[model samples]
Target: MSYADVNGLSMYYREHGDAPVTEDNPALVLLHGGLSGSDDFAALVPELSAHRRVITADLQGHSHTADVDRPIRVETIGDDVAALIKHLELGKADVMGYSFGGGAALRCAIQHPDAVRKLIVVSFPFRQDGFFEDVRAQQRQMSPESAAFMKQTPAWELYERTAPRPEDFPQLVGKMGEWLQQPFDYSEEIRGLQVPTQLIFADADMYSMQHICDFWALLGGGQRDAGWDGAARPGAHQLAVLPDTTHYAISSSPALAGTAERFLR
Candidate 1:
């Protein structure tokens, strides 16, 4: 339950395993998806921590962190992360973001390339097209019961809609609405990334499969592969697909950790 002060906001974070502070053993900053806090990486963190220092944080307005006065935006969240890295005096570190956090990580890396050694975006959205519009429309119709369930949904329950429960619908719906209103466009920024990056997508990710594919294409590479081909890129960019996994595989499946470790290594 560590905490850091960034731009007048209190950020809650957790660290696992042991690694030297020197650059020899770089650290990995893990950012969870929207509406979910650091808890989303509870399982994967331990596995990753064995080799590298792992840091996970509850972004402002989520989990133990204090809520922001205004609605959170992706760029603003990115800045918060930047500030945290500076406060810790970490010159540069690897970053892994899931879902909405994936967008935030991209923003952070693009805005502060010097602070990021490598980037890994999981099930990240790169465009703001009709797919997001559909998600927004569906969220607007959530009933009160569903809305209430969403607000207090546990981290694991937030991964899938068919988790055999209807309690967190309202909260999930509200978060989805918020996401729609404040979507990010990092397409141009991502194309210019100088640091090494790895884009991962789960086969069944409800939201960003096509968008992610489109983004990979925009990276100026050869034809895309169907699944985990580990396609090469012009400037250290790589794309991999995780089979038989959903949007929440990072938390729900241990296989994702192995894949990530192999890529990062």
Candidate 2:
């Protein structure tokens, strides 16, 4: 484990693979989901690291990285990641994020465009309203009590084992509840993005198919009929809806690594 003091954060990040740093092949930075740590990407990291250097970090208030007095907003955390990347003496890296981290990754692409080669977001959207009503309803129920209920789960177990402040778990949950209560939209930003990007979601993910298509439309996707020469298909941006997966199980899907690898390639 290595640490970098970026923007007042002693961020924890680990590097995998011995691939040399080069302009054509920047390192990959992987961000874990909410209440999850770097270990959340354990299965997918090795799949990616064999060919490139993969950096995994625990976001602020998760595990390993302690929280600051600041609120946990997507844009703020994205800034933290940009600072961390620059602190490492690198200009940029292809970023992949899951769930909560996915939102931050999207913000990084939005806020720090010059510092990204390619962007991948797994099961994420630009706005809180993109989520299913049931999911939002459940999010409203999050509190210290919910954290207590999840204390016995594997993600919580990992947090207790490695979090910088194990006692702050409930507070983290509350903060997330507050963050989700607010809504935002980044569709315009996505439409203007020049960097090649990929959006991957499970067939049964939290977002509706219509919502996903609406998001994709902003990226110049699903707009016109192809001329059969692959010339007028759509924009460079891509979208993938993995089969036989749900919001909870999508991270573990065998097809995710391969799909993302192809897109990153």
> 7 in model 1: Cα distance from truth in Å?
1.2
TM-score of each: 0.83, 0.97
lDDT of 2 by residue, 61-143 (tens): 88999888888898999998888888876677898889999988889888998888899989987777899999999999988
- For candidate 1, lDDT tens digit of each residue in 186-222? 6787777887888888777666556767887667644
The runs of at least 3 residues in candidate 1 whose Cα sits more than 4 Å from the true structure, single-residue gaps closed, are 130-134, 140-146, 149-152, 155-176, 223-232
Error of 1 at 170 (Å): 8.3
TM for candidate 2 is 0.97
**What are the lDDT figures for the candidates, one per model?**
0.72, 0.86
Worst 10 residues of 2 by lDDT: 226-235
Model 1: worst 10 consecutive residues (lDDT sum): 159-168
> Which residue pairs clash within candidate 1?
146-169, 146-170, 147-170, 147-171, 149-167, 149-168, 150-168, 150-171, 150-172, 151-171
